[model samples]
Structures are given as structure tokens and as C-alpha cells.
Target: MVRRMFLPFYSKDRGPPRIRMQVMGTKGRRFYKIVAANQRDPRDGKHMEVLGSYVPIPGSSASSVAELRLRFSRVKFWLAANASMSLSISRLLGSAGLIPLPPPLFGWRCRGRYHELLQQQQQQHLLRESELRNFFKLPSPISTQLVERETEKPKKEDVRKIVR
Candidate 1:
């Protein structure tokens, strides 16, 4: 039997896209990832707006760029919409003569990511370590004794007759 519908619980939304970015960075290094939000929502009309975006050009090599002059006006458009660049992205932009290098954002945001990653790593490590400890306790482990080798005299017959 179908349950009675509640208008408050089921509301259809026809609106703009929801998008955001997930960035990983340290004081001097930053990596960025873009994610589209609300795409999975049934009420979403189309692909959601980007939460964040990044310029993925490898920062180390300038010669890799094919053109001597290029425009990143599209990326700038996203920036104008309040999108932020990853540290690596900022560095790349600076190297490409786009924008000035940004200072380290070492407030709660930077620390918060570090703290979350650290906690996750610690939990994973503990889980693996416990699994290993449990696995070693299984049956069929053979015991062995440790002892030093005893010296033995060489037999004359076994030695070389030439004496060289």
C-alpha cells in the first residue's frame, strides 16, 4: 500500500546548478579537484555548476606550453564567480604570468584539511596493523630455534693435495 504523500518532505526544485571544489594543499603546495553538486538530485534540471576548478598544467616545465601567447579568459570567468584556485594552480598561474602568487592561507581551513587527512591515515594504519596481528595468529605457523654455528675441523682427504 502506498503511504500518504507529504508536501513538505517532497519538494521539487527547478533552480541553478550546485557545484563546489575539493582542494588539498599545504603551505607551499596545493592540489585541487573540481566537483559538480546536485547532479544526482532528481529535481536538478541539468549538470550542476562547478564547485571549484583548477588549471592542471604541470608547474615545472614552461617549454611544455605550445603557444608563446595564450588566453585563460575562460578560467578567469570561473574565478570571477568566486571560484578559488589551488595553491598549485596559483603557482602555475604565476609562472604563466597570469596572476600574482597568493600568500599561504594558513588559517582554520589549511589546518582543518591536514587534521582530517591525519586522522584518516591514523585510523587506516591502526586497522591494517590490527588485521596483520590477527592474521599472524592463525594456525600452521612452524616454530624454529636460533643457534650459532659450531666450528668443525677440515679432513685431510677433503683438502686439496696440491697445497696451492
Candidate 2:
């Protein structure tokens, strides 16, 4: 008699697969592998395939840069295959212009290229404000407010009211 081993087959009912990060490396120093995995699988568990890698924290040297290496073609393929992404993975891909950014979460600080873009926008806003003020011949609000404050003295009644 001959015996053969059979592998379990995954079915559609298990839900769509996910493209997410699989944590690796030692304590206090960690790296991630971007992978395609089943949605129901535990984090850092078995994965279908690795798409890329990410190094969030680089070495202590000033010249060191955070690294994020991805195979864009493979990533696109998995996305087209209906793979969802974890929140952090989605943010990373969004920064690369792979897809629209996910909705902002409370208390999340913008970093990297996103922060630079925000700074550029703020500078543009200030420039536009100055241009509008100049075109309208409006008095500088700071100077006018200072002059008004120096000219007006708080009455004794106001002080008394506050003291009461």
C-alpha cells in the first residue's frame, strides 16, 4: 500500500487576503517584511509571498536614512488580486502614490515627505495673505492693535468689577 500527503486548500469564504507587514528582528531593533497573507492569519505568521521590506529605524549615524524597498510590480499585482492592506502599510503605499491615503487618525503626526508638503502649503498661504493685504492697502493688524492698546487705559471701574 502507498500513502500520500494532502495539503489543505483555502476557500473564498475565508475572506480576501491582506498585504501587510510581518515584524522581524530583535527586541528594541525591529524590521518588517511586506507580505501577502490571509486575512485570518496571525501577524508574523505564515504568508503567501514577500513583496518588500521596510526599516523604520535606521542606525544612529546622521547620514542614515530610513529604508523602504518594495517591488511595485508585485505589489500592484497583489492589489489587483483583491488584497487589502493594514493601516500602516496603507500609509506607506499612499506616500508612494500607490493609492489614495486612508482617512486621518486622531493624534497622528505627519512625517517624511508629507511633512515637507505641509510646510510648502503653509508658506504659500502666508504669501497669499501678504499679497491680499498689500493689494487692499490694509493697515498692519499688529501695528494698529499696538497703537490702540497704548492709547486706551482700563478704567478704575473695570478693575473694581474684575476684583469683585
Candidate 3:
């Protein structure tokens, strides 16, 4: 008789495989392992393979630029394999340029609201300017000229003369 190792077989009904981080390390000092796992599994539970690691806080003596290290080839393979990535993992991958960033919350609705707010601000600014002009009893042309003069940048020749 021959002994053989068999991999755990998960059915489609169990849910799609997921790529996520598994928290490790002690309190205060934290470490994370990027892994390919089953969606039904617990956060730090059994995983199929480790894709890479993320160290949020490196050791004091370490001089490396980035704290995160990933195997891009393996990650790409898993992504192509139809594995769904967790939100946090997706954001990290997106920042690394491996994947497109998720759509902004509320999308076009936010842009429309921002434009409305900008219009309201402009209206308020105009109203305030008109009130200031009335209160100071300044002519429109004079006020406009004064604003232009204040906004104009001094020429290099003028700056040199001032410096001298």
C-alpha cells in the first residue's frame, strides 16, 4: 500500500477563492501574510499559498524603502484564476499599479454635488464683493483696477531694483 497526500477539495457552493491578508506577529508589532484562501475560511485560518508579505512598521535598523513585498507573478496568476481579493488587498494592489483602483463611492453623484457647491460659493463671493463695494462707496472700475494691480506679479527688473 502507498501513502499519498490529498489536497482539500472545496466545492463551488463553498464560495469563490479569495486573496487576502492574514494577521500575524504580536501586539504593537504587526505583520501580515498575503495569501490565497477560501472565502468561507476564517481571516487567519488555513490558506492555499502565500503570495507575499506586508510589514506596516519595519524594524528601527532596517533601511528598506518599501515595507510591502509581493510576488507579482504569483499574484497575477491568482488574479487570472478568478480569485476575488479583499477590499484592503485590492487597494494595496491598486496602489502598486497591478490592478485598477475601485470606483469612487457615489461616483457621478459626488461630481454633480461638488459642482453645485462650487456655484453656490461663487454666488456668495460675488454677493460679498458687491456689499463691500457699496459699503466703501468705491466705483466699480476703480475697485477692479485695484484688484488687478494687487494680483499682478512684479517684473524681474522691479525685483532687482527693490533688492538693490
Per-residue lDDT tens digits of candidate 1, residues 1-164? 21233222222563322333444556455444444333234422333343344433456552233222224664454454444444655555564656765544567346666676457556666666666667887454334333559899887866866475
- Which is the leading candidate under TM-score? 2
lDDT winner between 2 and 3, please give it. 3
Task: Single out the weakest 10-residue window by summed lDDT for candidate 2.
Answer: 1-10
* Overall lDDT per candidate, in order of appearance: 0.46, 0.72, 0.73
* Predicted candidate 3 versus true structure: per-residue lDDT over 1-164, tens digit per residue: 21122123333655556899999999877889999888888889888889999876455632232567899998997787677887778867875669975543476447776676457556766777888888989777223321334578889999999999
Candidate 2 lDDT over 110-158, as tens digits, reads: 4445675567556666776777789888877323221233578889999
Clashing pairs in 1: 19-51, 20-51, 20-52, 21-51
* Deviation in Å, model 1, residue 96 alpha carbon: 1.4
TM-score leaderboard ranking: 2, 3, 1
> TM-score for all predictions?
0.25, 0.54, 0.52
User: Model 3 — which ten-residue stretch has the worst lDDT?
Assistant: 1-10
